[model samples]
Target: MGDNEAPARRVVADYARPNAANARSSITRPAIGVNRLQIPPQIITMVTNTIQFHGLPSEDPNVHLSRFSAICDTFQEQGVTEDACKLRLFPFSLADRAHAWLESLPAGSITTWAGMKEKFLDKYFPPSKIARLRSMIQEFRQKPHVGGDAEAEPGDNEAASRDPGSADTVTDSVHDQRGGTTSGEPVAILGA
Candidate 1:
């Protein structure tokens, strides 16, 4: 009785990576799961179509930041919610890119959040609500000032909550600093 044989067990659920035994199963993983939808129906949240538009190819090898900026601009142009941009920045590189782009915007470009938001919503959004999208985006991008790719991730939910779909991302998809869904695979949604 000193050493008794025990049956080995393995958890078959939540199999993200491929399993040799289940080679025929093709249930792909989702970026965001339904269980994570913290907000209920009727709760106001920004649309997270951050990738709504794409920019032209960059000839420079260091265009990672620039590309990310281009993606952010896409959200602005397509009337997409800034929440998507904020969520996309959670992985750091995009946020850094966003920060760079925002910083580069002409100084005083957003002199008054209230006023600029009025204009932003006037054209992009309706009902005269969500008057802080522009500033919120600016703040998200401005967080990683000068800390582009050299810092450890603080793992803040700021990006996740704003753009839940973007948290835990693996793509530098915009610039691909990390990669894209090919990278780590995010787990939030609606720009969280």
Candidate 2:
């Protein structure tokens, strides 16, 4: 049988066969020092929105991490089991670009919620990458055009027309290194 195939039929067959009294006792016995605790299943009654890749862009790992933490908190608050949490988080990627990477992993590679989270952080927000992004954000500067009006700054307009990617040009949409919309206003990176 393939490694991925379930052993349900074999388990059923074993259970269906009649066993001798000694064999039954041996099969039903629990090992010493092993605790067989049964936890009650929790019913998720609240309707919570699922996290989607669209909401988390690849350039914003810090924001993605924050959002992921919130989702995990919500899952815990709703009484989702650890295993269930791992399964639930599989569909939710921290970034749109990461979705394919996550899908490419072998089935059941991430067996626990903690393991999945660790893998995600290691892949997307490595220490060196995070530091580089932070440096870029810190060095970012916006050069506002003189006179505040486009009509008043024909020279600046002409310069912008000549070099679209010039450092002196101010963009209408100023995205920080973490990809958060600053709206030209400076914003502190979360968890920085």
Candidate 3:
């Protein structure tokens, strides 16, 4: 190769290309069945109105996921799978920081509804948060009732025991980090 022509060589540093973020989606779309399935605008609007997660510290990601799943359950198309419906409508429920977090995920990383749920919970409801909640549950103690009569009558106690939904009893909705309630039973406390 002549020096004047410059030997054909590989360029080590290539010029920057256009950003592809806008062109690609983080969540993978399900394969279209025999008939193409589409979520209705009304369903999207309903989910948006009912659930909004901003990724705030106060927001419970589990609760948000549960609620979102519930809303997604309301509508079902013949060709659409449950996860397909969830994956489609889940994005509309996110706002502010939550939406940003979703956008930050790598393109095509989430292929299934399970993957999306896992990623969301791993980000928002981290292990540290779960530990903290678990610790709180372990350290929970009922505070003595004030202002009201400290001691209830024997008859009142009997009535409260018979009625599972009595005001005298308090039930803790301590969510198990892995799934549903830690224990589905109510923690009974007698007023004293």
- In angstroms, give how far residue 130 of model 3 lies from its true place: 1.2
Please give the distance, in angstroms, between residue 91's alpha carbon in candidate 2 and its true position after superposition: 1.3
Q: Please, what are the lDDT tens digits per residue for candidate 2 over residues 61-171? A: 556556656544553424335455434544544335566667566655765656666777777677888799799999999776443453453344443354557643334
The per-model lDDT (C-alpha) reads: 0.36, 0.50, 0.75
Question: What would you estimate as the lDDT of candidate 1?
Answer: 0.36
TM-score preference between candidates 1 and 2, better one: 2
Candidate topping lDDT: 3
In model 3, what are the clashing residue pairs, if there are any?
none
TM-score of 1: 0.16
Q: Between candidates 1 and 2, name the one with more favorable lDDT.
A: 2
Q: What is the lDDT of residue 38 in candidate 3?
A: 72
| Candidate 1 segments exceeding 4 Å error | 1-8, 11-61, 77-192
lDDT of 1 at 72: 44
How many clashing pairs per prediction, in order?
14, 0, 0
Model 3 misses residue 28 by how many Å? 0.7
Query: Using Cα atoms with residue i matched to residue i, what is each candidate's TM-score against the true structure?
Result: 0.16, 0.37, 0.63
Ordered from best to worst TM-score, the candidate numbers read: 3, 2, 1
